[model samples]
Target: MKKYLIKKILSNNVVLVEKNKKNYVLVGKGIGFGKKKGDFLEDPKEIEEKFISLEGLSDFEYEHFLETTDPKIIEICNKIFEMASSELKENLNPKIHAGLIDHVNLAIKRLKEGIEIVNPFLFETKLLYPVEFELAEKAVSILKENLEITIPEAEIGFLALHLYGGRGNNDKEDALKHSKMMNRILGHVGKKLEIDMDKYPFDCQRLIMHLRGVINRVEKNQSLERSFVSKLKDEFSYEFKIAYDISKIMEKALKIRVPESEMGYIALHLHRLNSYKH
Candidate 1:
């Protein structure tokens, strides 16, 4: 199916399209047609492959994406590349980069014909919920803005930690206190660097790693709740989003193309104790 950049979604399922020239296209019933203008819609089934476009991804993400992956991902990556600006791309690590492209493609595809996430335990989650979906979304956005990457799936889980009540008893007071604790530590560190951890463009990989380490101290020294380590682990999943951002910051600060995605995966494995023993 060839796509058209919608110049005008006409009345009676008709649209004005353009490809070098403008024309009105009719979407006939029983014979579906999706065409547009300005939108570089290629009929791979019709003609040969030519120049590919990156519509949504940043420069760093595009460079890494083009280096790896097949043309299929590229088609999707093109949209991502186009969507992102060069400045945004400069900050992504490959892992965050890869995850961003892959998930965005999947999300857009699913959403197009109407789709949704269907968890079997959705009812159970709603009943004795451990995490809030909204908070997870917030976490994911924060990860993207700060880390120069985004993973909608994992952040949902990370933010959902509020439902689990994260280490302390599941109470508002505890949540507020933990928020303050994390913020205070970040604030102090930010001050030393003449940067606000709250505002700095550091990846979550280093941030979470630092946080997880501090969490260990809390649990060990104070007989903190058993859930603390679990909380840290949950938060660790968000590192994928952050590490990608860190790559850019590192590149800017250190002038290095440090295999951002690889570092993110390494951090993930470390967090799960998958290969590297703690």
Candidate 2:
């Protein structure tokens, strides 16, 4: 049973749950609508177990049990709860909070076992990358059913905060400023890591979202900024110079421009490292 904290009760047995008040998805069940906000959805484990001992169960029944009543789904729900508790933003709109938590919970379930991602700087989500709520919802659905990988919604905000500050801070006015920052880091990663930033497994669509949001200041963005380049040089430890040098390779393969913003991104990581030293 996926234990959800109900956010809103829709008519016709459809209810929305705010898993961590970050992401929301609709739950359609007979009992879902009656549950009040902050109430936990009944555990699916008991329901699943009841179906297991039955003989000659119909395929449809078993499919439904696997989808909705599996114990493993409950375990995934719990893991998502942990991530939401640790990573969620404070003071979120209830709808957004619910969506984010639900998204994370579902995402962990989708990941293929032993899918190793090697990024010192950020958590790489393998799912469809979304720019807004509508896109996120649509992507979440596609990912939940089809793909076994997904990106968490708040990762962009977290990376932004790491490089700059809080959501309430420079996010509104500082556009080009961040573009420069991400470009540097991308450049660094391209140069130093065995991981390919442009090819599959580490494909273009995902990287583009990270680039425009975390490093560059672009609206309707689809590529990296200059700042990401700088991150590799100053903050990479032994990985710094190697990652810093790879900007040229990325630029050539991806046909993306690396500007002053990349320099700024590099500087921010360097500054952070320097501060940590003293």
Candidate 3:
């Protein structure tokens, strides 16, 4: 039996322990209560509800997170991770630990300050990642229960994105980058149309989902049929022009050329959006 020695106590529920020359962060209820440095912990597996291996993780970032973030927030994140792991039935990327804690802490702060950010990709996210979205709904419930605050629906989308990114073998950065690019493109669309996209949530969601499909097709070098291109270009010249400009934006951002066939599809969506403005 390997004996675990406490290296440091992050909070009442979190402690850094050393076993067999390996360091791990142990998390559970009162795992660190009355614990001191160099204290030996017997049967760590019996007591620890969650254990995070520090291997290949940035020490400075972990230390900074522990030093700066609220312990209550950390505890909540642990619970979220536990629930996610059980529901997902797989190991999540460890990188999400800091990201989730930071995001939740900031979200709570923003909500308290009455600063709410509208998530433009909410509909697309929920539609694409149904499992993660469901998990995010539960996560919001946990947040509401523990913090005694009402989390907005928009936050659920953000949480869903995080949960989707944290899933096994998924790159968190890529998930975030995809959403960010969509936001930029939507911002440009709103600017070009000279209308607030938020006011037309359904139309905006349709446009976002269309863009997501376009991006997927573009990345895969897949081409849509060109049968409607001429008709769309001739019938909705203004929307087609805006869609062309959006193609240029996508080309620059994704480093992939947008096919003209796909541009027609985008124009079709834009034409619908244009009607909503009337």
For TM-score, the strongest prediction is 3
- Candidate 1 regions exceeding 4 Å error are 1-135, 138-162, 166-172, 196-201, 221-278
The C-alpha lDDT values of all candidates are 0.39, 0.39, 0.80
Q: Report the Cα lDDT for residue 104, model 1.
A: 46
User: Please, what are the lDDT tens digits per residue for candidate 2 over residues 188-235?
Assistant: 555445444544333434444534443333333534454455555545
- What are the per-residue Cα lDDT tens digits for candidate 1 across 126-176? 222233544345444544553354343633532343333422344433443
TM-score for each prediction? 0.22, 0.26, 0.78
Runs of candidate 3 with Cα error greater than 4 angstroms are 20-22, 33-35, 42-49, 53-57, 106-134, 149-158, 191-196, 276-278
RMSD values, in order shown: 19.4, 15.1, 3.6
Q: What ranges in model 2 sit over 4 Å off?
A: 1-90, 112-183, 186-278
Q: Which is the better candidate, 1 or 3, if ranked by TM-score?
A: 3
Which ten contiguous residues of candidate 3 have the minimum total lDDT? 48-57
By TM-score, the candidates rank as 3, 2, 1
